[model samples]
Target: KVLRLWLFCQNVSFMAAGVAVVAILAYPDGAMAYNHTPFICLVVLINVCGALGSLSTLAGTILIEREWAVVISEGEHPSFLAKMNSILRRIDLSCKLLAPVVTGFIISFVSLVASAVTLALWNILSVILQYWLLMSVYNGIPVLSRRGRFADESERVGFVSLESYSGWMNGLVDHPYVSAWRLYLKQDVVIPGVALALLYFTVLSFGTLMTATLEWEGVPTFVIGLGRGLSAVIGIGATFSYPVLESRISSLRAGLWSIWSQWSCLLLCMGSIWVKERVSSAYMLMGGVAASRLGLWMFDLAVIQQMQ
Candidate 1:
């Protein structure tokens, strides 16, 4: 089970590296030249690679959180599991914020192909680190301790988990023992999940295009990078307030409020794009972007808490 989980995590990140490496090879002009066929191909490949990586990681997280949370929280005080999950969420948020800054800094200094190569090397090292970590810390990280591998929780979350949808159709469908919707997707759960997912998709999927739009409006690359970094900083800062908000209202309610707020900010962000050739317009756009991230993080914490 540990090996399977590791493989899923490994492939997700490894294929992300593949996405970058493929772009380096397939893009005739740099990625900046978006109107070309190769660029379109790059975008399609990236989305596909990113989706597979995400699905695998999500499956791993489900297995870990559901099965291992009990293990970690056992004999612990109230809210211990919750707080640990929060820490994990914050770690993911930090990565989202820092990645663009790191990538931009590298791209600013290096050739495009060189930067892609660097990204690929980074992912390779990450895979090696993951294995080393599995040996040293089991599945759990070594946050503040050094101890048989902390704990692995190597048991499968369930057998159904190992089977991909394609395999499920081929093997599980209509078999005497088979079932439909073995895992129920309740409407309440689905709605917030979709909302949270769409927010993430909007920010991530249109990111390159948004940057390009800013460039078209005369924004410098470093300036755009700075803006993204700022957005992340704002998101991180907003996370600290989630507890306060949850205390005042239900988590789902707080999440709904955040979703509404983000849409409002998105309108303002769109408006900023029309302010052509003005220096303040760039700042305006940055402000909008930061607002969106703030709403996003707030809603993210809220929904996840409610789900848990």
Candidate 2:
């Protein structure tokens, strides 16, 4: 339980950082530029960069977590601190995997903000390049195929099939679209994809009502906003619960990874929007949101691995 709480807190911290970055980028203005140019662009860029960061971060974290679990589960391993040190060491080494790309994003963001060149053009190009790079990494890795190297390692360690686990979960839960699907590979389950799509629509409907109808200044408005915000949190939390729970029970490595991945996405989305609203840049916000979603999808495989 300590480990679980610790991981959750860490996940929240990561997301908060993302949000802070976005907010910082937006603070140049009066915190209400939701219709401005720079703000929009910043929103998009943050979302994209954030998503990429989340995916890569999750992958690295999951890999290290699993490695740690294997070591600790052996029963004769070193003390807990030593095991943690081992994980940190591995994470440090793996930093090379994402540090360069993240650095590139930082450089690009700075360039766009500092230069007088057509900000929109540069922002668009940077987003495209960053997204392409992220996609390249996702495609290059066969981690999601359930027959890849990571999957093989998991299988050797008695990891369960994602499909089987999803099926079992669906059997127990009342929800329809909670089952697992790899990219486009939908299994023959009773829950139709359409029904699953409806869940997202429902969430969006609630978000829209909160943002559009509820005021934000008065006490009544604050209460409404708070409730709506909590609803959104619950929605996002629900999306991540299965992965977190399974990871805790089956493999702490996978759980941490999944939690981290979701945190990254949440950060990207929140940060990008915050930046856009502040700086008035539609491009940035769009880029950030798109990137975050793509990252989440790409990292979905690792989340599934936790159940195994």
Candidate 3:
């Protein structure tokens, strides 16, 4: 079971790395040029890679559960079909309760590709904002922890010890399954998303600077190519940093708080967008967004400190 899980996790990691590579390679002139053929081919490849990666992860988890069930049901002479049916029944129940998990994976995969394409179009800032919102929701609420529920008759509010908290967090950090998710979050999701955003900004900044410095007909294209190269480098760097960042933040709850604060700021920005009309009015709204993102990070830090 451990070996299977490890292999599955490795496959997902490779797939994510491939996506990052593809994004870098399929830059404006190479894959996304207004020319139809290359763009279509690249798009198909991206979709295939992402879909396969997600399915593999999902399938691996299901298999692990099945194995556990089989072990626990020792000596039961259930037929293959009966076993399959039993598994499916459990899956159905899970799907009903956790419908959003499936949806979240799908959305995350789709948005990743879309963000890459958007960056190709030189819409960097917009792509960044879109991903920031999506991931904030993914990591902050449903994925990291479940919604808070009222305490029940059997449940009591009690002081949790620092030692206990440390042990729990350490187990989460050391466990392969938990580590896989953390790697996915930091390397596959956050890094790629941030790289795309940075690429967009880099291209936009270059274009702005060049427009100010010199006259050119194809400056945007130049910016796109340069940004793509930079993004590739960022992707590579992120791959290397994944373990380091995970180790650093594993025990530090501050990082989680930062994420939460950022999410709150994101919500504020969304609300501001709905209420404010004028461009001039967006400054305060933008501040709110920054504050929220910062707040999440702070909250994560606080949690880590408490655990410590």
Prediction 2 global C-alpha lDDT: 0.41
lDDT of 2 by residue, 1-308 (tens): 32334333444444544554545454666655554665666567556655655665566466445543433334443233233433343344344334444444655777533332233334445555645654464456434322343444323333234465466574644232332223223333223333333424522232444344333322254444334344334334333443344334433444345445545645544554555343333333323333343223223333333222
Model 3 lDDT tens row, 146-254: 3333225113422233365576686665665764455445442455345334423431222345343322333344443433334333323322332244445542343
My TM-score estimates for the predictions, one after another, are: 0.64, 0.26, 0.24
RMSD for each model, in Å, please? Answer: 8.0, 17.1, 20.9
- Where model 3 places Cα greater than 4 Å from the true spot, the runs are 1-276, 304-308
The regions of model 2 sitting more than 4 angstroms off are 1-125, 142-187, 192-194, 201-206, 216-241, 248-308
- lDDT to native, each model: 0.65, 0.41, 0.42
Residue runs of model 1 more than 4 Å from their true location after superposition: 2-55, 61-71, 74-78, 110-113, 134-183, 201-206, 247-250, 270-283
Is candidate 1 or 3 superior in TM-score? 1
Collision count of model 1: 0
Task: Summing lDDT over every window of 10 consecutive residues in candidate 3, give the lowest-scoring window.
Answer: 299-308
List the candidates ranked by TM-score, beginning with the highest. 1, 2, 3
Tens digits of per-residue lDDT for model 1, 103-211: 7777778766666777667766776776676546443544323333424422321235434556657566534344323322433476777777777666432277878
